[model samples]
Target: MAEPTAPPAAPSLQELQHWTGVLGRAQQMMMEAGIDMMAQLPAAKAAPAFPAMFDPAQAMRAGAAFWTDTLELWQRFLDPAHAVRAEESPEHARDRRFRAPQWREDPVFDFLRQSYFLIADHMVKGVDSLEGVEPRQKEQIRFATQGFIDAMSPTNFPATNPEVIEKIVETRGENLLKGLQNMLADIAKGQMTQSDTSAFELGRNLAMTPGKVVRRTPLYELIHYAPATKQVFETPLVIFPPWINRFYILDLTAEKSFIRWAVEQGLSVFVVSWRSADASMKDVVWDDYVERGQIDAIDTVRELLGVEGVHAIGYCVAGTTLAATLALLTARGEADKLKTATFFTTQVDFAEAGELSLFVGDEQLKMIDSLSSDGYLDGRYMATTFNLLRGRDLIWNYVTNNYLLGADYAPFDLLHWNADVTNLPAKWHQSYLTDLYRDNKLVMPGAMQIAGTPIDLSTVKTPSYIQAGREDHIAPAHSVWKITDHFTGPLRFVLAGSGHIAGVVNPPSANKYQYWTNEAKVSSLAEFVAGATETKGSWWPDWLQWIEAADATRVAARGARIPGKGKLQALADAPGEYVKTR
Candidate 1:
């Protein structure tokens, strides 16, 4: 009997149907009321009149109405017994003492209170305006009344105090509206941070495996590139990435990785991953980055690969160092070993450095001098400076989205990669800012010297590919393109899309962005400017073609591998550990 009674068929179909009908009716009623209220909205916006609504006298009477409605609603939802229990909790007690709404001191709270009065004043004026209305117009009046009442309803405010919510609505209405619009625009721009590509995973996988560290006599790593065929080039390719960051920018990820792409294209590639400098490296000047960093890497690649000479690629700050190194090599009649050189978004002239000019002025320089007096530029300082350049998009946008919108935006691996910043040696930063930015001395023939030798770009005859970014704020395209004037050999100037990082790490797949090329045979920037054609497609293909043409002839036979080791040591993988460190 108990089993028979237990089920009661768990409410038969008819009972369920009845309940569903009730819910449907309730929903329909709400919708009808909402529609009726919305119908009363003005066909056209009314003209604005200052001091016509929410006058101080009207607000006083309105405030009384809001207080009465708010207290009734609060009492229903928040029982006095529940409040007493909540107060018993230590967390609640602390919040009540320190975080409770202090209307007197809080501007936001005061504004919300004022909004309550404003609503009441408007309601009174609406009633007064309806004095001459006929019986048929009574329905329309009721609709309008309902609309205003709905807007100021206690249920509309998420907070217990309706007055506080009202104040917030009044005080922050325009700003909140503007913020919402901006957020939508950012979403459309795809300027929002995104996850690093699947290619990043491939690169990370390659670099994490165990490998050998074959230290050259002086310094540097001779990374071997094993191609499909024995018919490889006579000249080795050595990549000199700046010590300012990690070397991985060249080899970023598999797809966008320039180093990997070169290897696939049949060019043997060797990238130098500079060691993180320690406190002892404070005295290590710009010369050390060139002679010791790039030159040493070149020699190791030559010896390991058994090539006649190496083709060098310098990126950003590394490019400048390479220019200096080339000058020194040329002065000593040692430039014959080098083939072609490529500079990616690198600046040699500093006079028109764009926004960077502001931070490198006299007062800023003095501050930097004091900070870097201990020798190495602190990494945090450098990161702060770059972050400031795009503060709205990079910093404030995230703050609003995360805190205000309560959006847990997924962290982009690339952004995470960017945030993992490394410190610069004090000597390098101080000398760079003063000599390059402040003094504008690098482009001059003998204005700057490395290792006591006057460095000059003209002396080095390596054909060059100088690429700049149109949207790049860090190194303006003009400042970078000026390098062509300093070089006597054939030069190709490319202007790509996006900022400094995106422009350089650009993949061929991102074909939406384009580059411009000056007319053929126009060697100088001025000539290019007059005859430049905006070309579609990625600059990577163009750069690859240029480098391939400039490359020295490939040997008929594969040169013998350096004799010393039978099984050469292998690098761990693609994205090495050094690149992963912050």
Candidate 2:
């Protein structure tokens, strides 16, 4: 009647219930079929004639044991009074209110969060593709999957959903408890705060290493080491460690120290330890470092111990300085005093300096200019720059372990030494960056000048030994090897294992570390690169062999005296006061 309208559009309770029941039945049927198929899959995959040695009994027992322990832990954690207090805690309240909404409101982040689950769902289907993977590899893959799932579980998500909130609270509480326990354990084991003490001790030890004060025209300390017995060579050995850090990196510790090793090997070792710059040293330029730092030390060594010539070992930036010094001396016909020179982990060419190039661009130069306007390149600035190069390991690792994990810092002497920062004269640093890094001028003939003479490496007739590390990111191998081509001397280039610091600190005990040497003559790096083979052991032994051949036979021992003068006044001991002056 009511216009013969369609039956009142309404779902009766009975109809609704019937449809729900049918849906329930269909879901049950699908679940049962899925379970059955899953159960038969392993049987189908079982090797041809033999059944799997399925240890269901053992698995059941293990599951029972795990559940039993879990129940006990759950009971302890769910104490009513404690649970109520934890729920009302500040952290919990913060998480429940502000943090959850803030996290969800991030647009790009929400997209990523939703996309993760979709990708994970697809990955579950992709597991079938791994059927032929090795059993161990399959287990590894499963473990990795579980690990990722655990990391991304609701417990780690900040959300308003009841399940996610509860899980987050529970997991964070557990983590807090574990962290406190670890802190206490470390304190009891005497591992906590060891880093600070170790660093302090390293500074103390470096300050105590005896250094000699050799007074020349330019006042600087010359750390000298002469073997107890007759010297192996008539040529004195002088070591010029880079001024970027302290000179003592080559003499870090007695057992593994390079300077100690060279001294014990019967070579006269003289190291140039530059003083930390003061207001007076503000105008010191690159030429000043060579003239006052290297050349003055050379004159002191020559005058103090009258030697026919000296063998020089220059490392990193010091090597560059030494090469320039050699060129200058050659131009003036004064290079006859140097018989041989060795460069360690040093770069003459800047075409491919790797990560170091990134920080030397215009912006950084401007920043340096602003800061160094006071005449000194602040040591802190330099330290921060180097630290940024490997921030994950250098900076963030310590932050996470110290602040988050509440773990004690592990002290390493080398790291302590590295952190002993030193400032560079602003003029020297700015000129270095602009000339060497920006222009790559030092390696180019007639591009660099020292003491008013155009310096060129081809005129460097001193027999040369060049060493670089394969894993050195600061100075790429290609950039370092370019020095060989620029020189006409009998050059031997060795490639060592490890990075910049480790490469220099390498000792014979590190036998597993390998190096490459070209026994046959090779003109360029390309030629040597083609024929090089990896050989085990430290490159020091090889360097020593080359040095011994260049050194002259030892003559009668002369007392410690400045040559061309009356007998020299003796200093306290071998390691004099100069190096110990910080």
Candidate 3:
């Protein structure tokens, strides 16, 4: 008790001053760190003049209007009784964020919230006004700026976020703890583990369609889905999905499976299940994908079906590969192997290949080559690039749910499929990036080569049905339309009303999206889109109709179409070992 009465006096003035100086130094260090982070943002060469956006007066007018609205919002927030209704912008909505009663009714947060939007809007304007920069550089700048803005979002921090605060209080900080654990777990994996692996077992719940692996090569396995109809079409349908992902995207679930729907429609459906490339397959080049991947699948399908003609489908990069294969086959006078061809979200002309083209510059290509010293493009690298293309949905969305809210995202089949990625062979990926993406070579007649054959897409005379996604960033609709310019055959082009995956995976039953069709082939994409009429429901039925018209003879579908019949032996069950590897 006596010692407590003589409690230690306050620290000496010198000690207090020293502690103050230490705190000041710590703040200076933090500020320096922040400046370093900003300095590390991607750099770009100046772009050409921004159109009308370069006028200073116009910018000032916009700034004045923004400030006026901000002042009004502030005035309303200052009022005691009047509840200020937060303005909702399309890209960055704030009112919808702080929905909890405590936040919605509070004036203090209202001011903080609107101020963020105003500042973000200013930042975007500044980025948009950037002139004399290359398109890739511009994209990098916009992307970096967006990352910064998203990081600064109040909703990401519990102290500034009312919703997170309420969640913390209600859950007694369990949410924060779970979020930290989730973050640490992802950091340990060196990648964002987007889906709950415990929630899905590949062969059982995901790629459960019943079929047989009719043939296998060093590169892929060909799976023939069991026919769900009593009679099947005479011309067998072979699909060449992009090697960047597993073929099961077309067979993700029974109800939504494009293969199942085609099989049900009485078409003998065969999918190319591309093997996830490893260091062992590093020598595999684009020719291998063409010859061994698509060409081999076609040959096996012909042997199994005993039909000289087969209908072929290619999606995204596979569309490019399939087109190349068909061209090579046509050059070799073996074009009769495929009766008809359908391209989904494919880009033969890379002139307008959308945002993904930004990653194919000289520096990026060198980096990729260095990475491929092991002989394959890492699947995680490919996945990360694709995620950045749609950062808001694929990156930030998962980040918020998994790291901020400490919650598991609702189990989504598409999200699961997206998370599942495949590697590209080093030689193959290098050729693809250089020839297709960088040089825009495939569109040029005889500019590319495969299996010692000079490839020219114009020689690919297979009757084609080209389907594009309206919002596809990987393969823009404009780029897909350019394929029509290269093809000499009858081309039926349609635009589905969704992005890359959604546009193709759209099943008729969902009735969730629409499509656009124009029978007349126009010279420009604008004309095509203008003349096209929007049709409700999925484009699958229309595509089926097109393929069906190519070969109308229907035979009795008594048994499931297996792969190994005459020469090729049955390798394994459907969704073979290749798809389950990674």
Candidate 4:
């Protein structure tokens, strides 16, 4: 027996160039027809800020530094000793992009990886080193620069990426052919595939919690999950997931479903499945969401069960509005309408709103208005904007896996939910940014109004629980903690580990991630951290304990709201009509 001959040498640079061009054409098809991804980023449409970011004086010094690094890198590349050795710094070791053994063992690839980082570092610091530029403009430039660098990673390209090159060689160019096919399939689907969507469905595998849609309106479907326990708490619990995505994220799977867990633990759960916005909802505004969407749900639920107040949980943008709804109820002398409020990774004080704020200025707003049709912001456009938030993980990772390596996406419940994007009323979306994100007015007393009532977050007396993700980019934990400044109610703030989705969707059964807790009121986030105690595992159990302790009264299973002829009419099954709109 003899070993198989070694595969042919990696594809030539010229051949790689052809594949790169094919990739460009492939991406053109992935975006939804008649939608422009660039319209969301007005800054990107303007001329390059070579002069502003790197004025002539600064450019010269940066150029000299770059050339010096390039010469040193070239010299090392020519020498077998340094070229053959991997860049073994702790920083490089942590980069997932350079984790492949070929990046270290192969000389040519190692040089490319090191050179790319060298250039990326210089580019980032060039803007940081600028003296006279406005802080906002400088920040925008820095974000754009980093996005460009992430896009041009050696691993994203064919010729430079050792793993991609090897895959191409091993497959005898079949990978490239299959990659094009994947691109075409994604194009037909109208967005990039983040997971094996075919493997999951709402009623069968995902959002399978036993429940029924008790109420339906033009804007939302109110779902009342059947009592898993024999008895339920007196105070009914309602959840308002962010309208930007589907509602079923909270009820992904039986084991992972937060809704199911809450119900099984003896709490009655009701969730608002917001209607996917269309041109007919063009007239909808911020107050409409507060009045018709959230407040209405609360009103109906209370009226049905003859309950005085409803316990509320809001996640992301929904949490942002739920805070305002509390204030609105207060202004109307109906503060008691809501018994308690729980916010998950929500931002009321946008002072530290993070990267999402980068696209909330005048130019971006006006461009969105113009791009909208019948006063509706297309879901596809919004999806692209969000995916760019962590372009490397959300966008480029799939680019390399599905296209470069010709691999299929794994079946991930969360990613499947992510790809099922929802549209928003243009008027409402613009006002959300202008009021909360851009102006930072939700915290200010009487700064904004909902349904003619002033929003004074300080007057919100409802006992509150706020949970923020420590590693969350969308809503930074520090910003979430700012809720403490205004709310006079007894509040418990817990900082959970991981990013936005992972942090919030965590279940006790998974035993994944950790959370921090502090009892004393602190002036700054730093102080809160200093006085806090760290506990390992999911924060869900902690939240359950906090909410459960407040409402201990129990009712028989028959007393729980069951959809039927006597009670509210069953609109449809759980993961109802509105959730399946798209």
Question: What is the model-wide C-alpha lDDT for candidate 3?
Answer: 0.76
Q: Which candidate is the best by lDDT?
A: 4
Residue 87 of model 2 has an lDDT of: 21
Which portions of model 1 show Cα errors greater than 4 Å? 1-213, 216-222, 225-231, 521-527, 555-577, 580-582
Q: After superposition, how far is residue 536 of candidate 1 from its true place, in Å?
A: 2.0
Q: Write the per-residue lDDT of candidate 4 for residues 1-582, one digit (tens) a residue.
A: 999866445556675456445433432332211113222334534545423533677667877886677667655655544553445568767999888977765545666677677767776787588665556766776787778778878789787778888889999988888888998998997799889878998899989988888888899999988887788888999999999999988999788999989988888889999999898999999888899999999998898888999899999999989999998888889999888899999988998888889998888888888978687887888898889999999999998889988987799998989899998999999988888889998888888988777788888889999999999988988888898888889898999999899999889999999999988878888998999999999988888788778888988877435654326878788888888886
lDDT of 3 by residue, 379-418 (tens): 9899999888767667766666777778975777777887
Q: Residue 259 of candidate 2: its Cα lDDT?
A: 77
Q: Which has the higher TM-score value, candidate number 1 or candidate number 4?
A: 4
lDDT of 1 by residue, 1-582 (tens): 355433112335574456445433533344345435533433111213322323566546655664454444234223423432111235323422123344323323322333333343445354444333442233333434544444443223336233334444775655345545655654674343322323344245333322233443222444454443455566767778767666655554455666666766557666676656557677878888787888777877666666667788888888888888878898888886687888987887777776666676565778888877666666656766776566545554453444233344563545655544566777788788889987878777888888788888777777888889888878888889878777777777888877788888777765667788875876556677678888776788887788678764665324333222324455444333454444
Candidate 4: list runs displaced more than 4 Å.
1-57, 82-89
What is the full ranking by TM-score, best candidate first?
A: 4, 3, 2, 1
At residue 228, candidate 1 shows an lDDT of: 37
lDDT of 4 at 441: 87
The per-residue C-alpha lDDT of model 2 at residue 568 equals 45
